[model samples]
Target chain A: MATSRGGAIGPALVLHLAVLAIVVVSEIIGLIRVPIGIGAVILLPILYAFALGIIFNPNVLKATGRVLNHDATKLAGTMITIAIMPFIARFGTTVGPQIEKIIAAGPALILQELGNLGTILIAFPVAVFLLRMGREAIGASYSIDREPNLALIADKYGLNSPEGAGAMGVYATGTLIGTFVFALMPPLVHGLGIFDVRALAMSCGVGSGSMLAACTGGLVAAVPDQKDLILALAAASNILTYATGLYAGLFLALPLTEWLYRTCAPADRASTMH
Target chain B: MNNEIAISDAPAEGRAIDLASHAVQLLVVCAVALVGNWVATNVSPLEALPGMACLYAMTIVGLVIAKYMPFYLPSVAWISLVAIIATIPGVPGAAFVNEAVGKLNFLAMATPALAYAGLALTKNEFAIARKSGWKIVIVAICVMFGTYIGSVVIADLVLRITG
Candidate 1:
């Protein structure tokens, strides 16, 4: 029922500009705050867009439906693919001088970077035993979600299948809120000042380029003194996550998650019977 | 000179014109996005316009280089690698562009883009998640929680040992 209109660039641009305007106005009215500098202001736009979409849906301004559909919304996402590298590259410039710091941080930095996998470790068991999900659900829910893993799952299980639905569920959640989580969490954690800033920085590097940028941006803005080091650590850790993540997700994360699911969860027939 | 020839030629001509128009539209969109990025950052238009242009130009050049690489490398990776390499002090033109563009607030640029993503949410996607039931939310929450805890433990331990 909510399928997109596909290539309507004109309507897409108009809707995007409208949402952008709302965000700017909201920021001016002091309805929103960006203590972590200009980067953390992303939440405003999402809020604006979500609100606008809901108000303008079929229940409200029915004529505005075309502007709020999947196609119009996706235009910005496709544009994001373009913006991501430049953001990271600009971030990369700062890393040049921080090489020595990165080397000094060494293995500890790597371990902190490994924190990105914490979700997989925890989710695998929860998905299997607690949720009673099958291998497909466990695999889809366990890793850093992006296109490649989704494709792998789709290849093994048809897009219409239950596995596909599982991937879709997580993918939807990740797409919708992942950036917000990354942007807000670090600064909140850092503001409390419980952990080392470097550890916070390394923790920001959870693979996805956009999230890395968001997390690192908030961390940098929050702890401006360690800006270079934070960004450097984030950039390096992001690269490792991206480089190793696919192999790990498919071969290591998914298989292991599936194994845990089968071993721990009651059989599918049993769960259904319950 | 026949009707058939004119009809076939008209379709071919229309296709070419359509393609050229699409390309122009794309470039215009790129410019608009740059402007949006600049405005969102609260930078003065005078200072930011040229800086945004330069930054975008460099990214385009980086994309071109990535396209020509023998092996398959995503443009984002190549762009970052290229931009980083160019930022070295002695490299001509790199330092200037890096200085100007690097100052542009990344979060500001990302904001509208993400807002666009929010706007993109369709009822269909929502329906699918809903149909899958509350379990999907549970899975999503657990995944997010797991990530947070994992990061905290590893980060704290590493810092303690290293610091």
Candidate 2:
């Protein structure tokens, strides 16, 4: 009895209305700025909206939860990319004003993408040696394991495999809590007061939109006046991630992870290693 | 999983709606973002109406292009391309586009978009995370920090050297 209509104002419409309500409420709640460590952090309306969205989650309560239901919930999730189009457009518009700055960024914008390799370089060792995870570490620490990474892992290794589950672990956590975790980084780094704000902003481009948004939001919160430059750099770096992250993950990171897996996987986990 | 290479695995994009509803849904989100822009940025809704309208139009055109284009580029790419083309320095009406669109804070719009994303999170996604054990959580943090710090260090060194 599923209606299966995309644009129809069905149960999903209720979800839309709920989003509108969150927008109104979170905005009015405004930004809550607090001093933490060396720099300050402002809780953007998005944070409040995210918290409220959790409260309104179908699993947590039966209020709007009941109305959102399964179908409605699925639709809400899909709307994520479309919902952020305006922000993407904003990123686009801002880029034009400072195309020169982007050029001035030299090879850094593209080279920074190499930083994605850091995931396996660091996470792999932690997963293998410290956590003693199995073949799962191969998939888990390979990449950020977003949708594309998940697909790549699934293609190379079936979803039910240990590797697949490992990817899913990181992917699921990324979906559930990645935003908040990445959001906290900018200010903490800013507190150290080492990296230039522009460089830090560029690092906020971690591939995922919400994560990027939260990261850029955090950096701007840490360094306010440079909003323009921060966002433009973030968006540019993020786009490069979208463009190159998959190939890099597929050809480079995963292979490196496999070699590392062979070298460092626990005895029991390494027995049948690929 | 499908062959279509895009960001999220959630659902198909424009295939979900017709032209009219597509336009309507975009408008609705834009309207919500407008309210957010007013509240968070201290700009009146009236003052930013032109900017919202401008963004809305660009979004519509960009989506249309994404739909019709022969290739498989994502909607965001086309939308961003249109916006970038419109506002880039010597383009006609670039200033008007800049000033008008400037009225709306991009972050303001992102608040509502993420609110929708927040509402999108489901119980199943959470269950998967929990079943994975706490070890993965630490791994997730390490991965994120390593990625961020690694990039910051590289970009900082590159920028300083070039400067």
Candidate 3:
């Protein structure tokens, strides 16, 4: 059961426009401060992460509607996360590089496998767990059979059904894993004498874009319900994590994590759709 | 009964544009920008602060324009114009172009990787065999090895070419 299509288009257009405006304005402001630029990039995925939490959560829009209590808590948790992330990143960088040099057999092939595992273990799970806890604390709920109206919209666009949403979730998980792994590259590269901040930023952007595109595509195909909202929120978080990882991996962690997932586990991908 | 249930479940068909929502979004963007700028100042010593007055003016004007027009095209057009006017020869548009390209590149890489992963998950291929955790670990180790070797190969190629 869908409403007449007339009203939906305008609101969707407005939301899209709003997103564009935010990106444009933030990028412009970013030009003045390099850290701001880094922040802008990092913020995208963080925002996307939160949006995914909302989209997947059965009670999100309703919770978001109750701005005073539920929504406020979620927002507060997000802000707290954001506030501490930079410090965490700083610490990670300081500790990572020194450990890299000591453990590596030689300075040249300094990509430490353990570093990658640590990133996967530390970053993705922490971010996802925080998001899930925040959403739950904010009273967001989910169930196997209770599909919201937004899911219908997603279905109409040929996205994942409720049964298929897990596929996209896995993709998000993978991206997070990949991002943490790539985080070590900046330091590893620098240890080899390629320590240019701008260049590092560019490389990070490439890695982030790749992850975002992969995640977006999967979500669009399998979990289109509130894809726009999810993307917007997740993008914000992604930007922050990427920036922190960049600073941490390059400056602090020398022979950073050397993990990569070139091909997906066939069983995990297949089991995702209903 | 069915009709009523369907009708009630849906959000209002045509509630007027939520100006409040738009306003909230704008406020969030501005707040994030301000905080981000403050953080950047502490982190990057070489950065030049964009004039707050100019930034506010630009953002407000941008918001106003967005109300009546499409968001991305106009904003990009305006930002590009500002950048062009601000650019000086030999200064290089590296920052602007690099930032833009970097965003584009992230999206590009993310799509395929996510798709593959999604497909794998859906197919139930993402399993570690019993007593085979070590095998999975080995694969992960190999991935690390591959990335390092790959980077080294590329770096060597670049150095040779440059020399």
Best by DockQ: 2
Considering only chain B, report the TM-score of each candidate against the true chain B: 0.65, 0.84, 0.28
Model 3 captures what fraction of native contacts? Answer: 0.01
Which wins on TM-score, candidate 1 or candidate 2?
Answer: 2
- Tell me the tens digit of each residue's lDDT in model 3 across B86-108: 22223355344323222221222
Question: Which candidate model has the greater DockQ, 1 or 2?
Answer: 2
User: Lowest summed-lDDT stretch of 10 residues in model 3 chain A?
Assistant: A137-146
Tell me the lDDT of model 1 at A100.
Answer: 74
The first chain of model 2 has a TM-score of 0.93
- Which portions of model 1 miss their true places by more than 4 Å? A1-9, A12-16, A19-23, A26-61, A66-77, A106-113, A191-193, A268-274, B1-41, B159-163
CA lDDT, every prediction? 0.58, 0.78, 0.28
- What lDDT does model 1 reach? 0.58
B57-119 in candidate 1: lDDT tens per residue?
Answer: 656666666556665444555556665666656668766866676656654444444444444
Give the higher-lDDT candidate: 2 or 3: 2
Steric overlap count per candidate? 2, 0, 69
CAPRI class of candidate 2: medium
iRMSD for every model: 8.0, 3.0, 16.0
TM-score of each predicted structure versus truth? 0.78, 0.91, 0.31
DockQ values of all predictions: 0.26, 0.55, 0.06
